[model samples]
Target chain A: MAMVLYELCGIDEELRFSPYCWRVRYALAHKGLTAETRPWYFTDKEALAFSGSDKVPVLVDGDQAIADSYEILRYLDRSYPEAPLLGDGMAESRARFFKHYAERSLAPAMLRTIIMDLLNAIHPKDRDYFRETREKRFGRALEEFHSPAKGLAQLDAALEPLRGQLKESDFIDGAAPAAADYLVFGSFMWARVVSSADLVSNADPVYGWLERMLDLHDGLGRSAMRVTDVEGAYR
Target chain B: MAMVLYELCGIDEELRFSPYCWRVRYALAHKGLTAETRPWYFTDKEALAFSGSDKVPVLVDGDQAIADSYEILRYLDRSYPEAPLLGDGMAESRARFFKHYAERSLAPAMLRTIIMDLLNAIHPKDRDYFRETREKRFGRALEEFHSPAKGLAQLDAALEPLRGQLKESDFIDGAAPAAADYLVFGSFMWARVVSSADLVSNADPVYGWLERMLDLHDGLGRSAMRVTDVEGAYR
Candidate 1:
């Protein structure tokens, strides 16, 4: 195969929900490339060991399997060159500002809102691994810290900086959606796919942006399998 | 005058400490432009009336007067076109991400740590106006909300994303300081000038960035007057 991508999925392999994978997914579409996506569960770290990172979103292109979504995105920009992932002038460094903002702020805020929904959606074989790893990372049991309401509020407050920009521009990257937009879109995709938390109210600009994001790539995000379709997603 | 910037000052006209004004000051230095900075106090709202703004950091270049620090920064880029304040391509929009992060996150976190000190350093004549307006905005008297320790911790948390970036790059913009650097530096300058709270420990990456910022423009920040010298500054 010329290119292949490893993704994390749920009880049903179609329900891909990892935010990091979503970033790479959107980036590939942006670059106009196609890769056969292989759904992998959390229990299969050995499958990803070839890429030197026991994480999903590993892109195998030809002889090289690049691990890490950011690394893959950079590799795409380097190899493709036609469709750029980062910007010119000061965009690369400035974009890192948004990267960290989304990673440190948005992911934490959105994850709390949807962690339980995510746990119930992952494959049965991956449940304990997910729970154990996440609980250890959070230092508490999943049920003990699931505050959907508080999480939604933090997501709102955490989005103020992006909200200010979306008010004036269509995308975070001005008229066009680029890496920065995809960086943040991944989190909202995770929240939307795994839960019914109503993360952002309809009145919010973020909601409108989310809608636009779903509409991008010929409605790729809107077509993703949601918690409602999965058998064990708290139904 | 070719150019003049209206700035908020303290008991001494030289103790310029408004974070917004500091952005414009640093931006001016970045572009290698010279502007006569006029010290304005909080009591004199009428002095800025002609500019259609009740704020500091209003820039008047030749016949045109622009209010708001952001507008002034953009104005510099448009007019000067050399040593651009914002980046090219995706840089402009991406840079705004850092701009708002600094404005909404860093400013608030840093402010709570130094609010009381700020009151003590502002021109004694402007004290009542500053206290009344600020206390009303904050929904309490300054003393009621002065939790310096908690404030410092919050500031520390707020700097996490910046710290992550500074770990790899010398400047947030990479090698050269730009508008984004000034965006965050303004708040730090506010903390350092108006208070002795030691906002960041000496070992912090942010502290090193601050020291480097003070070294810029022939130590412009280092040369500014501080709360230590003023008799009424909580001595």
Candidate 2:
């Protein structure tokens, strides 16, 4: 059976920066499975149309096509029960809380800081579509929303809960990386691959957690094609 | 074995409003256990001296005493082992995340909205102590921090994650109210007992969750003595 993951890539298709896609990638690695990466651009809606969702992170396993990253993770867990991602004892609800927290608070704060870098990293054909759609959603120009200083402040405050948790445990899901850890880790992966922005200070425990996360699953995140690593802080 | 719970109560001893204390009370009910409620006032610090902490919700079970709501919930599961509040498997980490969320994000957002009412609801003798400590912590007077409008706006936005979760499930921890649900329910319980600020609109799913939470454990929350019922929107 062939497993394929439709991921949002950049002008250089090697640069995969979509946080949601990163989530599924981590989940796949966590479950000891492999998927053929199908690079997708923002304007390439036709590629994802078969999945009934106009977004990337569409995963096709055998005959089933899954749209959302979360749904794909769930589908994988249901399909592969070996190394459970959600953990034991109905921890699915807890993982869901982390998803909401990341989407509602962390991602917005991060987007504010790295939107410009993200714009530069996407496919050339996606620049217009990305700007137009994002601007429409925000009801303002990307320049107005892009404030690294203000965003960094908000991001730190938004991460207070995670930072507090990491102080007591190594990972969000504890002992080992699980669904809860992967959900929040997606936010940092977006920033890590696209921008050179110092998301967390070296003194902070979050910085340590980031280093540990990058080292997970045979350094999958660490081996990513980061823009900062290529061009030396071009953003 | 006799179990006695020392809880923080207001001037009217029936009026208990400490969110931390409420967390334990709900956990106790969830475990299908009862403890003799000992109403404690803020000025009554000497009463909690045996717990080695100057806090309410000190649960004395048999010969052991436990402080902190999270610790007490853990203790309940460890001692009782029946009707487990944290749930099975590695759900402990998930419950821990909720603790951090409630303490760091939810509680602060809610305190800004209900601090004034909280002050008024405490024992008259504790007023001066409360004002001094809180003022020092906030670096300002209570009057400056008592903006219900600004606080309400931040609170509604802060509750975005919980609202999203409640839309899909009856409780934070899924169909049944677990440790995660009790962790957050404490914040709303604080507002319910001390003030009638209309925390959530009936139109919101969070409002529905609150009503459901109030009715849980055989109307344990609904039966709580509230200041609003006594003096009709006086705040």
Candidate 3:
């Protein structure tokens, strides 16, 4: 009955808990799924191997080896359909439309920004740890992190669609949180963590909705998990 | 009750009856959904607007507007769960896993090659018509397609996990076609229509899969009406 979410517990300052991982964390909590946390530093190669990817926020659910936050979210929804991630009726379709946009378009921008600032933004103490670890897996110098311009462009393109949605509703779909909210939360959380809070801070309903989500996190004490040591474990 | 599928009938030299579109096409046929065809040219501006984006292979089921091929497929599965796009148990999971890979990874490379030769590859008679239409929607010169390097790299990166699947199984899963087959079929068909015949012919399992999917399309010809145009009637 226990699932383990293996993650990196903050190895650096800029190495915040990945929004990709955070989505799954929220899902497990939402579904009330009993999950054990496996925290690791960037040095922990063993955890990455068994998880099938070096990426954190991997869900080990019994015999199922699920990677990718979206996949993990899907697995959670199917396994526990009572609460329902997409929500009810027409909302399901609307939620999915925005969630797809968030994951496919928006999150990539936030992630790129985080990676681009690896040396300066990341905690100096853990910089070597992250560089050494990622080098082992990606076989590239962290220095060659791709330009953030393309990522930002895609993000802005994605947000163009949402501009109308926020104008109409308090949430991406309507009044309630759906998968889009959570998906965006993960990325926006990254923005929040890295001091790049302007991305959604004043953006209408998203701003208010994000505050509500932060409240939920505070209520649950889930946000207590720091971004430095066990950060990759949650990534 | 007959479910009318709104479709365009003409050849989309760029995207054509790609597996992505055909996935919907076949699903409509399989579910016994009565859909009308609305054949369109790739450059048709109004058609893209009606479809919610400048993309083809959109299916209009009454008022429900489903865009992404993945989202459309999922909608079909939910709306018509009796026959089931995904079969039972492990069969379904394995099928879904392949599809996730196809949509996320395989399609981009196919897009890269196809977009490269678009001008020369589209039907010569429709050349002017095609450019004008595409320009109206995408707002870019047809010749200045930027670069295929990024898309190619993404496609290759996405294919890494898929290469493992191909090595293990023939159909990207097994003997029968899964959703992955349908998802990937769209990209492959696009490649077949837009890439040099010689180039598409040389693309390995992608090339090989195209031949097999042709058989599936052939099957459609006998039982279902071949749609030729997308019209406002479906709206």
Candidate 4:
């Protein structure tokens, strides 16, 4: 029997554009599993009660409920090991390294950049909802994210090590798509999708690699919407 | 033939006892695999270089150099499936859930608590080395950890969810010792070994549970730290 997954979409604006979610989406598609995504507004209380957490990208598979992104990824990997994400030997090691980097290092910095310009982009009514949800998790106002300069600088500095590696290989580990490639693939794709160009500015190899990465997936973003509500009817 | 693992260990104050390292140690013991531990201090830069990062509890088996703690656990689980971490279906799922919680949620707050308290307890002379090393990863001064109140509060709050569960079940999952037990087990054990009764406070079920857990393998904090270093020597 196929597992049923419910993803709370629309809460994280750039989440569809998020490398974390993109990894799950790609894995699901790669494994040929079907899932139901419900477009969620952060202001709505109904979603949280049903999901058990306000976090977007909450996955529900039968009786199982997982919140953290990596846990969900591992669950899928174990459940379906045919088209394995870990590949073989060294490839497995490399995949894990990149995934960890993306989650721990890349995502935090990307969040800083997105928050800096959130108000300018989001619909006025949704801004309050975004702030409230974020404050619940982060324990501060959205104003804290206003000055993303420090975060951006830190992120750029962190990328120095990776940029050095890009000078030689097109991918982080070796040739072809390893675990690291999926990360680079997911991150760059989401950044491009959400219009976060500053994430991958002009640099020797990283910028060039980003362009090449998008080409592999034919340049389309990774997620499809699962729920829509119109005219007082939820579908 | 047993798998050959290149391991980094020792120099008491260095690496300052990471939970990530303990995870691998228990997993190794669980698998009955003996790995050679090479003790390295902060002054010893050569060993750190091969690790690809300045992190300990690193395992180099053949050509693979893995960094993340969770990934290392998975590698151990896959490579040595003899004394299986994930037993049967229900047990496997339960183990995965508990282990995931330990690795993802509990460890972070536990780390914050340990790092904060350890900074305060260590001698003045060693403080500089400790602060400098930790600052590199955590991005702040040990002084920031001077106020462990906030860190402890967070840890308490994070652990609140497990209160009900621990009261009912001896282990995080059900009756048996599973992977989750190892994950949580390692953290508490580290705390117990380094600074006993400081980070974790005693309160009925949780406190009683900790004592019961310690008794699992004859009261030694983990299958007898198989790769032990004696007198600044790499064994």
Candidate 5:
């Protein structure tokens, strides 16, 4: 029984753009596991109904299904017990902090910065569903929420902690990339795939770390299909 | 030789309030080690000159003098090895993230919120030096920076990451309060000891975690002499 991963994709199925999905993708690659990735769209709710989740990045292993990215990552480590995402109990706990930090701080700022770009990059079928749901959640029109200056400032401020951490170490989880690195790299991957705007500058230590992340697992992230050729903008 | 810790204090020598100092204080207690705390003020640069850094929380372990809270915490764990501050390398790396997060995000927001209170709480002898250096750093008059509403909003936003993590675990470092927990708790201790303003609300998970932190090491934080009696305000 092969493992299957449902990944959120753009107009081109090869362009997997969801940050949460990217986390699982990176985690699987880090653990040296490959899964049959099924491109999922925002409107493809019926397809995921079997997993009891209306979300992408849902992992279906032989007899078990994991909905959340964190859950899927934890499941992979526990089930495989080889090439662990979390090194130990204490490391696992600390990784949780980075995961939450990315979720609560980094991703939201990135979302604000590239919400429109993200909508444009997604399949045309997902456009209305994406805009409507996102606008409703934000309680503002899609256009109104797009403030590049404010979003960039917030994103820069949010990156400060990660920047400080990266300055001291090559990766968030120390010598090697771990669950913590993937948790944050997912956000950068989301921006890279959809937005033309450069989120981080070349001088920032985070940019160097991002380059290292892109080089991980045989250039997994660097080779990913992007909607725009804005990688040069960051450099 | 007995360990000696130089802590930053206010007009009343008992009012130990520096956030960095509090991290070392908590680290010492967490390691089940007691140090003879010597109160150091901003004007007393000569007092710390021997240590080669004009900073509080300088841990004098026998003949070795360790400056900086992070260094002190790492030294304690390395030298003592029993009741370790950092559990493992990966955990230590992650704890470094929390330490950096608190230093980069939490402390700056907190400093904004309580700058005036901090000025009022410091020793009269250190007032001129404190105001001069702090004003120079902020690039404004101390009075001009006092916007309670803005400061509170910034502080609340800064705490979102920690609040999210606390919702999932008992402490920042997971099941137990470790260096990560102390790193964040130190900032709260700074607010608790000096400012009468309640930085975090009771409804916040961070508030509960702060309460638990106050209860740790046989009420070490709870029993500390505070310049203001606003600990009840958080409750």
Candidate 6:
């Protein structure tokens, strides 16, 4: 049986915009493994029931089913050890820091900037569920909560640590892209695929790192489908 | 020819509070090495002139003089190669992420919280230099800019990433304290030695990690001299 990865997609299946799913997508590419991507929409809970997770980015390898982006990355690294997503035990722990940092800091900042854009990009069927859940989480309408100016400033501040680190090294993992790189790149992929707003300034070192990340894995991320021209939109 | 570290100190020679210097102190302990710490005051620029850098935490090992906390850690790991401060090249890179994260995010937040406290903690001779430089940096009187409530809130928000990661592991470097642990611990040590304000609540996982960090190296951090009682203040 071939390996399969369930990815969150829009009405256009090629519009795979979930940041968590993008993490797994990039992790697979990093590990030099190819898995058939199965498009799963936000409303498709039944499709993911076998994985015991309501979320997309579920990995089914042979008979084993794995869920959660972090868990899936760990599983891939542990199961395939050849081209490791995380380097070693010590490196893995450090990678977890960046993973958590991105999850807690960067993603939320990005979400606030592009919440409406994300809602529009998803499958029309998932619109009500997304809006209802997200509205409840923020305690306000999605449109009201998102301010591009405020979101962009918050994101720029959040990106400072990453910018500082990237200025000294080519990758977050240094010398090479790894799990930490993908963890952060996933957020940018979400922004690229869903939002037309310029999230990071071209002058920032983080912008340069993003270019390097997009160019990785045979231009896998570079070739990704975006809501607008990726070059013009991101720059 | 012995291992000697020049650490920043207050009027009370024993009251060493420079965050960068504390990083070296803990890092030396992590590597199972001992260095005789020399008290260096902020006004004592002539003392560090030989090292070609006007900085605290200048380490003199045999004939070699190294400056900068991050550089010193790398030097220690490379020179000793026993009980390494950084586990490997990969681990070192990952550690850099935390190092940079703490430096860029955590330290600035902490500095805001304790700037006035830090001024009060420095040597009487260094007071003028300290106030002049710091006030110039902020472009306002220290007292006007600082609000313990606002500072603590900013610090707590900045620490969210570290708090999230620490919930899963014993240390930032994972099972044991390493360069990254010392990198962040140094900032807390700055707050610990200078400020009476509770930067982290006892319920925070970060507070527990701080307890663990203090207990490392036979209570090296715990036994340090503070303007106020460290135990009563931190708790």
| Tens-digit per-residue lDDT, A52-162, candidate 5 | 999988999998889999988889888988877876677788888777788888888888888888877878888888888889999999899988888888888888888
In candidate 3 the C-alpha lDDT for residue B220 amounts to 53
lDDT for A215 (candidate 3): 70
Provide the lowest-lDDT 10-residue window in model 4 chain B.
B226-235
Q: Write the per-residue lDDT of candidate 1 for residues B20-109, one digit (tens) a residue.
A: 898999999998888998989887889999999998989999889999888888899999999988856688787777778778777777
User: How would you encode candidate 4's per-residue C-alpha lDDT over A1-235 as one tens digit per residue?
Assistant: 4454444334343234445666666566656676766544445556657657655556677777766555666676677776555453323322444554455556556666666344433334566776777878777776776446866664674455466556646655444433455654665544444444376678556787766655554443423321121122122
Per-model TM-score, in order, reads 0.94, 0.95, 0.53, 0.44, 0.94, 0.95
TM-score of chain B of each: 0.95, 0.95, 0.60, 0.69, 0.94, 0.94
Best by DockQ: 6
For model 6 the local lDDT of residue A8 reads: 88
How do the residues B1-235 of candidate 2 rate in per-residue lDDT, one tens digit apiece?
Answer: 7699999988587888999999999999988889999998777889989989888789999889999898999899998898778865458887898888888877787788889888888888899999999999999999898878877776776788888889888998888888899998998899889987787999999999999999999999999999866553355
Number of the candidate with higher DockQ, 1 or 3 = 1
Task: Give the whole-model CA lDDT for all candidates, comma-separated.
Answer: 0.84, 0.87, 0.55, 0.55, 0.85, 0.85
The parts of candidate 1 lying over 4 Å away from their true place are none
lDDT of 6: 0.85
> Where is model 2 more than 4 Å wrong at Cα?
A229-234, B230-235
In model 2 chain B, where is the ten-residue run with the lowest total lDDT?
Answer: B226-235
What is candidate 3's lDDT per residue for B100-189, written digit by digit as tens? 445544554445445545555444455787678766755787555435666565555444434333433455434544465565565555
Candidate 6 docking class:
medium
lDDT-superior candidate, 2 or 3? 2
Estimate how well candidate 3 is docked, as a DockQ score. 0.05
Report, for all candidates in order, the number of backbone clashes. 0, 0, 45, 1, 0, 0
**Model 2 docking tier (incorrect/acceptable/medium/high):** medium
Candidate 1 has an lDDT of 0.84
Worst 10 residues of 3 chain A by lDDT: A88-97
